[model samples]
Target chain A: MTAVAQPEPARRRTASPLARAWAFVRRNAISVFGVLALVYLLLPIVVVIVFSFNDPAGRYNYTWEGFTTEHWTNPFGPPGLGDAMEASLKVAGLATLAATILGTLAALALVRYHFRGRGATNLLIFIPLAAPEIVLGASLLTLFLNWGVSTGFWTIVIAHIMFCISFVVVTVRARLVGFDRHLEEAAMDLGANEYVTFWKVTLPLIAPGILAGALLAFSLSIDDFVITNFNSGTTVTFPLYVWGSARLGVPPEVNVIGTMIFGVAIAIMLANVLFQWRRTPKGAQ
Target chain B: MTFFHRHRWLTPYVLLAPALAWLVLFFVVPLFWLSITSLQEGTVQVGYTFTWAWENYSNAIREYHTQFFRALLYAGIATVVALLISYPLAYWIAFRGGRWKNVLLLCIIAPFFVTYLIRTLAWQNILSDNGFVLDVLKTIGLVADDGRLLATSTAVVAGITYNFLPFMALPLYVSLEQIDRSLIEAAEDLYASSAKAFLRVTLPLSMPGVIAGTLLTFIPAAGDFINAQLLGTPNQYMIGNVIQSKFLVITDYGQAAALSVLVMAVILVLIAVYTRLLGTERLAG
Candidate 1:
């Protein structure tokens, strides 16, 4: 607590009024600037949420028409939006599942063992992340085109898992690196085999990281545009649908879905944070 | 040794195999194919062939240098602006948010839950020709009565900065939050002015996050096509837009592949420099 507390008294004894005002501005500048920046960052979100209720007179919901709750009650806006949203969910769900499982396994291997070619494997996992989305998309498209595999829903899922596994591995590896190995050793001493010790102890401890990684994977897959845009031959995910509609003046239903996603994500994250906060005592680690 | 120790040497490899195989098939193989495609002579109708054509690389650069430069310039400026905008916000949350730090961080991230296309589209509406932002600028004499805000470089840059601000903010927050406040206090205690203390201690210590944030912001921002497509005119189109049109519209696979490889190579080189500057362990940690 004293980290910031003890410094307050040092600035109070300034002599002149000008100096005092200067000091005040200096002290408060970062805080004011920060809040304003946050507002700028969130302005679009406020617009999106508020606009969800708009009863636009036209196809596009660009201008604010008088407020109405019509859009929120209608899950599908225009013609194909509901289907697109469903497709997005399906792809994200499958990709997240496959990526999480693969990534968790890889993270376990990386953290728990010293092996030949481990360094190469680490680089391989990292390369997808470091590569730009546009480049990755185009390359993948080229591969698919050359390989005679038509691009669509399955290609989107494959690409999502490809990019997402890196993030999952990175997240889970961080958790694993911080793990208390002694607990596992203690379990072994208590006559538990490796599998029993893992299921009973390690998995439970790292479960939060796994969940976090899965959530991250889902958000990324669902929100993806560039990569999905490339490989989606006639397949329309939510973002792709939005992009296509933007040319024709987007429907208010887009904003409705946007708001719903925002609300759900925030709720899940808050609940997770609360759960973790309750689980850990201060400085227990 | 436990039961698993009977084949301990194989355990890690077995665990890693599935994910590794997935990466190899979807990620590594695609990139290899991209490399081959880059040197091929191609027309989608006629079917492409490997012809050792290197002009695809040179011609893309010569043809689209304007877009390439614009992409670099836009991404570079956006990275700087995002850093400047996010640093104080992140600093405030880290040092002063205290009991509200997690909540503050969540607020910072909340906007991103909205679909990316929607978020960009929201900006498009807000800065529409007759919308709030332009009206304000017009009223304040920042823009002419007939001058438009949308379809300009400023709008494009601002959109990029706003979209990537969270990427910049979160890493900066993590680095700033991890700083030992006692170190800052010690500098103050030694009679160094607050500004001097911050410059010599706080800024340098947070370089890893700053570097990481810049890379995160720049790479994606450079590769971004939606912002320019939605908010700006043909004049504002970036390299990403060009590459997209090449692959999908123009159907110039070889040129697109070469351009993708070039961009990836450039990004890889930048990352190598950054990694060297950060030192490998700092990046790993």
Candidate 2:
């Protein structure tokens, strides 16, 4: 500790004010840049939220006219916006559930057990992650066409699940890698059956990870445009609706939906953080 | 229960079966099916037959080479921009955020929960000819009287960087957060300046995150069409736009499949080389 401490005073003593100022600038540059970067990230979302209440005279909401609550009062004023939102929600829900289950199981198998095809399985899972969305979407379209199956709701769900599963596996597996396996062994040693031990001991510990993965899958599915575009045929997800409307003129209700989704997501995330903080012992932190 | 306990080797396989089957049927088979479809010859209306048409690959490369190159160039620029914008924010969140670290990280990610199309469309408003950004730029003499921000390659790249910034930031934050402060202290103790210490000690340690972040940003950006479609004119369209138009607008499945396969192959080879150059061991973290 002394050796570590010695350099600071000595450097301070030798350094001039200009040098000290330079050092301070160097030290704080990242933090400053970080704040600016955060602002850049939030800029578009802010536009969306602010524009949600803007009552444009024309169909295009690109320019703000004046503030009004008309859009919020009739949030589904757009022709197909409500249906598209419903389709997106349904797809996101089903895809998240399926991806979470499959991913958690794969993660368990990969982390808890060693087998012959383990490396192959890992590679297989990663292929989807590394592949571009365009390729995945196009290829899936081709597959459906060749198989004599048309693209629609089921096809969108399948496509969402396919890409989403890989993400779920990656996120859940990261969590599992840090987990302590001895708890499971201890549970079993206490005369609990394997099923009971897994259910009681392992499942609860990894539940947060699973939930996080599911949230990620849900968001990815809901926001997805490329894959859904290819496999959606006549089906219109929220993103598809937005794309179609952009050519004509985007409605203010689209901004309303965007703001609502953002609000709900932020609320849930804050709640999670608050819950975690409350649960953790002060000393542990 | 007895039979399950006795045949424990089958447990992993049984657990993995559902996901493995799902991936094999949807993911792996589609990749093979894509490759086969790429080799077929015909239009969507006429129907395709497999004659091992290798020319499709060459034709895709030959015909749309400009779009392919543009896609790579745009994605490359966007990745670099994202890295530049994300690294400092990630570093600050990792090291300087203190008790608010989780919240800061959440802020970086919060904007993503909104629909992607809406976010991109928001860019349309922000960069409009009479928008505040352009007005400011025009007043500052950074932009000419008639110069516009929209319908340009720069707008497309900016949108790509904004949309994918979180992917770069999160991985970087993960790796940077794991770095021990003691190691940095030790470097200072050894008489290294802060900048030198960061370059020698901190930078090298974060290479894995850098590679991961870059790949995460670059891969998706390369295939992204929404930014180009929404922000830029046809001149700025990427390979994704071309593939999307082929599959949906023109209904040329054969060419679309070929282009998709080519893109996938190129990305795979690039990733392989990247992993080899960076050393795959670092990625295990």
Candidate 3:
């Protein structure tokens, strides 16, 4: 298939130098732009990594100074940074777990069965995604306040779960919609009970989707700022910490943490990719 | 257990129970509460009352109309910029990336894992008055002697463009990748130039992605306050900033709820009009 799709070298060989050059440019323009776009996206990330090693002369790590491993060596040296990170991790961990469980079940029901209010359920799931984060945050804040519940870590977690559930549902549902139900039926026909079929077959089929959804929920919860800001009272997540300190001067430790996160995420993604690669035949790729 | 097996219809509802309950409790209820809160009258000191103060909406618009328009304008520009940058990138990955496609896609999303606040902060360093970017611009005389990049509307818009670029790219890639290669090849077989083939076949086919990407980019960017808050001054403040302050700092629940409702309402209307303009039939998965 690739061989058939390949351009004819004979036609290209007959072209004049200028025409060939123009054709090359025209053919590769999109790829060139893609590379440039990737560079644009990574520019700030590179800056973060570089600055993480810098021994800044002042509180703000904006200016470059002599290179040092101080920030990396003691990432939690900055006051409030560790606390904020702990808060963020706590919220993300809890939110991801809840969202994943609820969302996986919802996705299963949505995809595997026909039920009343299914259309409404689908539409309801989309509303949070379409609605602005500010509105979600504000509405939740109002609900908490009206109920006389103080805004704090719990409020942030609730807000995070509210928004994160929609994404989890969407992600898991996409995977479920493409799933082959024959396998589950086959397992049942082979004398497996319904629970056994679900545990041994259906769950395995959807595990990747659930895992992806959980990762997304975690990232969303951890990276969230807008929604977290409105609901959080005195509690500070990492983003809130950065927001507060930005006016003063952000410490280099923030950059160190950022770099570490980037590194970890990339490592996980690479592992997933390599796993997928190993599962597929080389020629198929 | 026998009763449960006999009533097969109950199973899906059971599966969906927890998720639907959570969504209803947290999302739907708060939305209703937000609407009521928007109509309430009072400050945090006196506590809010359900006086049906419809004028809160008018007052919010009247007072913060500048911020409202500025938010839309900045978001619109950012969406357009992101689209312009992302289209070619998505096209390349879809049609030309071959086995490296997933890797390239991962690279695009990798920066997002670093945390939104930190990425924006890195931009602060990059676009600082005396930073490398501005220095180069000044040296090239594109900027005046005293001209700066940070704390300007440009920086805020750029920050938004940077943050939401992936949201634009991913959908576009999906749509582009799904295009039938045979259509383009058939066009070429009919003696059409490659550009003509692309314009007539590929461009028309990718409209769904374009619409989806634009909405995904624009909606969030419009509601985003962080970029404007972190990178721009008060003069560049968007509606999100105003809503944030009204909710958090000022504790003026009425106005904040009103503004939140207004933003959500406006976005919903815009999305409706946009989908209609693009044709709702194309939006279905």
How accurate locally, in lDDT, is each candidate? 0.89, 0.88, 0.89
Residue A192 lDDT (model 1)? 99
The sequence of per-residue lDDT tens digits that candidate 2 reaches over residues B34-86 is 88988899876678999999898888889999999999999999999899888
Candidate 2 predicts chain B with a TM-score of 0.97
Q: Name every residue pair that clashes in candidate 3.
A: none
Tell me how candidate 2 scores on lDDT. 0.88
Using DockQ, give the best candidate's number: 3
Reproduced native contacts, each prediction:
0.77, 0.74, 0.78
TM-score of chain B of each: 0.95, 0.97, 0.97
Identify the CAPRI category of the predicted complex in candidate 1. medium
Ranking by DockQ: 3, 1, 2
lDDT of 3 by residue, A116-174 (tens): 99999999898889888888888888899889999999999988888988899999999
Alpha-carbon shift of residue A175 in model 1 (angstroms)? 1.6
Tens digits of lDDT, candidate 3, B37-151: 9999988888889998999999999999999999999999999999999899998888778788889989889878889999999999999976999989999999999999999
The clash count of every prediction, one per candidate, is 1, 0, 0
The TM-score, computed over Cα atoms with residue i paired to residue i, of candidate 2 is 0.95
DockQ of each: 0.69, 0.65, 0.71
Model 1 misses residue B111 by how many Å?
A: 2.2
At residue A164, what lDDT does model 3 achieve?
A: 89
